[model samples]
Target: MAHRPDTLEHAPLGRDSAYPEQYDAGLLYPIPRAANRAPLGIDDDKLPFVGEDEWHAFEVSWLNGRGKPIVAVARFRLPANSPNLIESKSWKLYLNSLNQTRFASREDVQRTLLRDLAAAAGGSVSVELLGVDDSELVPQRLPGECLDDLDIDVSDYTPSAAHLAVGEVIVEETLYSHLLKSNCPVTGQPDWGSVLIRYKGPKIDREGLLRYLIGYRQHQDFHEHCVEHIFTDLMQLAKPEELLVLARYVRRGGLDISPWRATPGLTPPSPLRLARQ
Candidate 1:
């Protein structure tokens, strides 16, 4: 299988008196399929949130009959208040199941996944599926640039410093990005990749900004929710004149998802190209 949970250790999540690794089998990443998972933030738990932007994905998968990788690009939109939004862990588990699936055609795979993911998320999710030979339809450019992993240090906030309530940026009018590196709050297994944030408002404190991002260094949350939480934090804290927060995470189990959000009037920056691509 492209994604093998048996070999990949994970953080556990469930009810157990002994407090075992919070690993959730469903939270497995690098799904055998061409997919990825992203959570907004762990702190956004206290707020009411919804999916607002369009999700564009470029996926490469292999067919059971051909044994060659087939490429697909999907665009899914979730309602702001869609109930039963598939939790990150569960979503990963679901994608991994596709490994053994052999669809008659790419359309069948697209239709099935769109229907199933939408149903699991409790809202209509749109998907644009494409074969490897068809590449013209996917998004061409992305926002921001590749990050240099600034050797961030989080010694002070290492052991549960504080739950994420909100973040403050010390830098003024700047563009910053950090590769996303987090773990399952349960198992402590690391989830990785990059994140980009750009805004036109007063620049936030860089140190504070790093601290905010670092806060999640040890904390665990889904990629989609993490980005969303960051969006909410900016709206609540700095309230920049114009703001855009986007993260392009590396693929796990062959899947990756990028989430974006902004104020009603402001438009999000285009997706960017990073080394991982």
Candidate 2:
């Protein structure tokens, strides 16, 4: 039953809107990250993890100098420590604005994206425009054992840190589940995704972990916030020496968002899409 921050009051989500006729940097909307983090007991100046939000835009199209249409995909990386998180609907609308705009070259489009996104994020944002045939666009499965087949009783659908527990056995492992689903805070639309956990510490109770993840079924939040919540919950319950929590969400409006949070010194996982993405 968490509510979106007051900063999102005027965001483009949940309301009807028309596509922009031309490029408009002003279309991008940003919500302060601290607003959501405050409730989680996370301080903006002392974040517990390091990571980024990987975003892919699959329906990008623009005009070349010759007035011919150019189609390509885009990848964006926004640092987790950024001051703000861009609103997804506004991001879609901002990208849609480029549909009829003309750019001299792909680099030109990328530069514009980088500048605008970085400004909105309040941090440096990585923007890459790739051809549709780029290999990075190929889908792959998430690493580790899938927890979807476990037969466990569950009734609650709200997230609770108490559902997470760990055993005495110490081990290093990776586990994942595709049943992670949460609703959008603004529009209440379902956001389906797969979540992966990697840690080196006491053996976590798989059933409890799965139940904890499933508890978000009726939760409301953004993909980045959800991953952070999972990460924080695990850290509090297991006290792992190392931990990483990642969520790869399905595409909505031609875009997919994957957010990962990890203890310092752990390398990030490959930014690859799952088959369902």
Candidate 3:
């Protein structure tokens, strides 16, 4: 189905919802990416960057072949060009449906999730189930300089490109800040996160960049869209030759969303959880 801004009103967000007693793929809501991309001058067929929406479900559980409870964490990688983005709350509900359902094995659960999520996202999605002790799931800090120590005054809390400025010095560096905060457009609840920005081109004014990130404190949007907005804004304002923007948001409803968009050939950084996640 095509996405419209108003379609979110029908999704299982903002309103109280019932938990499903059985596995129901229909509970997953797909919001087409075009609806939000249109405002940013992005075409679904001609995306500027390649990346993925890495989702970690921390409260995943299901019954085994013998009806014994099993618990594991799940990581889902959704392509950036996917036709649709699954609404977070609906994703949580869909996972909850599996709590009482029985699976033959972890492989079976992973296969089922891959099939359902790929279909919902309208693109190939990778699903991996990890045991609680998986070493790869360890928390790590975002690699780069932290900008939160900047003693700068700020008043604007709205998203704006005006705060972004670039210097003539060509450089490649990674910078990050933990001050990223935005609101959910549907529920008005806050979404807090850390953001990493890596680029190669004219030097981006650090103070201006920090101000630009802090500007999202009062803005409202989804995680994926916010990252895309930042990517596009920097591409236009700073004219970076190469750029990557990733945000690791704190988990809500037992799930965390980390979306990254990068230059066509640049590899995405590891999807490690931050301390706050």
Candidate 4:
């Protein structure tokens, strides 16, 4: 098991806490990204990939000037270069605080959230607030070649970069699996997710890749960090000319995090919620 870094030592992840009915930005906690990236050979100054961490807040509510409650869903986009990553539990608490606050307009609420989230993320954060009636709420299946149907025997459950054996011919392929599971660095709670990998380079052995992804079953890390780790490992071991890695985790506390990392020039995939999310 990996040791929890000092940055997460003070987070409210595993701790019991009171929910604030009043608006309070103090509820937000930002953990430095360096702490987790260090082990993966990721340096903020010279990042090998460009991506964003997409977060969906399903239970957002606020009071209007008329004292009537307004409800909506929100999407937050935090750049990968952000110096800090907001802790999910604290993010939930912060959103809960807005339940009783009155906003002059929806734009006002969005601006406030954008500013606060950007500050917490240590980078510019984009926020989109939408009504529940929006058609985007529909769930969609992940796009790629499903690897879950591969009938293979598994023995090891720990992460291993060696599993990504390469073939002689270069190819372009997108592979996905719903078996990606890791634990919380602080609480040891299971974090279940599905991962998609698209690359244009030497072919990666399918069975080996599946085994490699499932290897994270006992690994402990955040969603964003885990995605980066996968990206870094593939770039180093598989030696792909182009690669993109994205992982979508199930909703826990009305929020689901999807982190993606891709080489320059590749457009990001659509931010669609999976069936399980």
Q: Which candidate has the highest lDDT of all?
A: 3
Per-residue lDDT value at 266 in model 1: 49
Q: Which residue segments of model 2 deviate by more than 4 Å?
A: 1-6
Residue 251 of model 4: what lDDT?
A: 88
TM-score of 3: 0.97
Better of 1 and 3 by lDDT: 3
lDDT of each: 0.50, 0.91, 0.92, 0.89
Residue 78 CA error for candidate 2 (Å)?
Answer: 0.1
What would the per-residue lDDT of candidate 3 be over residues 48-162, giving only the tens digit for each residue? 9988999999889999999999999999999999999999999999999999999998889989998889888988999988988998888998898999999999999998999
Off by over 4 Å in 1: 1-80, 88-104, 133-154, 158-174, 267-273
Cα error, candidate 4, residue 260 (Å): 0.1
Tens-digit lDDT track for model 1 on 59-170?
Answer: 3342545554355655555544443334344444454445445556787777777667665554677776654445444334445443344455556433122322333544
Each candidate structure's TM-score, on Cα atoms with residue i matched to residue i, is 0.61, 0.97, 0.97, 0.96
List pairs with backbone clashes in candidate 4: none
Point out the higher-scoring one by lDDT: 1 or 4: 4
Rate residue 184 of model 1 by lDDT: 54
Q: Which residues of candidate 3, in runs, are more than 4 Å off? A: 1-6
lDDT of 2 by residue, 98-174 (tens): 99999998999999999999988889999988889989888998888999999999998999888888899999999
| Segments of candidate 4 deviating more than 4 angstroms | 1-6
**Candidate 4 residue-wise lDDT at 141:** 86
